[model samples]
Target: MSAARWQRLVDDLAAAGVESSVLDKPYTESVYGCVHHGVSRSITMLHPVSGIISISDRQWSKNPDVWVGWQVFREGRDSIVIRTWPITKKRSDVVAHVLEAFNTEDRT
Candidate 1:
């Protein structure tokens, strides 16, 4: 996925009031590592790994399998990538429940 696409995904998540983070910084560096890294590819390759969802910690982490649709590939770099999992209805449901906690509109 290109940086533009990645930004769009982030924007969608943000608009939906879903909280997301880079988890890795210097976006290019992180993208490079993910594409070339071993476990990183393995973890991200599978689409929407699960159907049933559960909450743990504060971050909304999900199985990549169930939502795996697109992986963000950095432009002009073969070794760079930013992965994005498709938003499933199931995932959206979960996001809605927790969105109040993150949604700007929900805040007073």
Candidate 2:
């Protein structure tokens, strides 16, 4: 299921002309999270647990009920990969939003 989700995400991004990469291995280091890259700025997508914990603690204020599964991180110059899911009322909406945001951002 996750693999399918990942592929769909990749396809969607590709359709939108957003460059992204897939992290095939588990990420272990804080500095080298599961997925790391920069869109307009550097961003790291830690493992699901790490991503949720970090976002919850700092950004979402540790809201357990809040969904924080989907995440994205910079893989390299002008590239990023989706690493987890976002808490949203609608899953499709969340995906669309992410793609829209990425596409809207200036690559150069």
Candidate 3:
């Protein structure tokens, strides 16, 4: 994705109250989504091809990447990427993990 589109995604996430930003410089990215989970203290990014959020990038830290959740890319299946797709259509998927975290926290 171009810088403009990436900016829009970051803006959208901000609007929804999710802290997010694009990587720059040596960690430059064509398309990136680093979502930080407060409870786990982890960050997961959306896959460029399948849209499935991968485990936390080791390059960023030791946080583990997610394999499967509400959205994930696997061999036979295609993933729904929130950043590249329409905002309204993918809103739920975009916030799935956040919501899950809250719900789990409440029950604990």
Candidate 4:
């Protein structure tokens, strides 16, 4: 990914009020060794106490156009596996859905 594109993604995430941190080269290289290099490509978005989402540089996922959630031991893992395609979805829609999950009082 180009630096400009990466910056745009970071800006979009910020505008949505999602706390995010860019994964450094060491971390990204270790976790996503096959991903493109030379520019920022991975970030971790945190939803307060609700969940964490990984924006990987891989750009493609098993499901190319949707967000995938995983549960841990029958409990809400509160984790979402987000790839490039879904991140390109309307931010309002993504933010709304994520906010709904974060705002829910009952996790069961």
Best by lDDT: 4
lDDT of 1 by residue, 1-108 (tens): 334434454456568755454322232224325642212110111112221112221213463223333322111112222222233334344345434322222111
The positional error of residue 102 in candidate 1, measured at the CA in angstroms, is 12
lDDT for 19 in candidate 2 is: 50
Tens digits of per-residue lDDT, candidate 3, 6-101, equal 455556657766666655423323324854432222224433333234212122234234322222211212433232211222435545543333
Sorting all predicted structures by TM-score, with the top scorer first, yields: 4, 2, 3, 1
Cα displacement (angstroms), candidate 2, residue 95, comes to: 4.3
lDDT of 2: 0.38
Candidate number that wins on lDDT, 1 or 4: 4
Better of 2 and 3 by lDDT: 2
TM-score of 1: 0.26
Return the clash pairs for model 4, or none: none
Q: What are the per-residue Cα lDDT tens digits for candidate 2 across 7-97?
A: 5655665676545544444333333354443212112233322221111111244642233345433222334433333544343554565
Q: Best candidate per TM-score, number?
A: 4
Query: Candidates' lDDT values, in order?
Result: 0.31, 0.38, 0.36, 0.45
Model 4, residue 67: C-alpha shift (Å): 17
Model 2 error, position 99 (Å)? 4.5
- What stretches of model 4 exceed 4 Å from their correct place? 26-40, 60-108
Candidate 2 residue 93 Cα shift, in angstroms, is 3.2
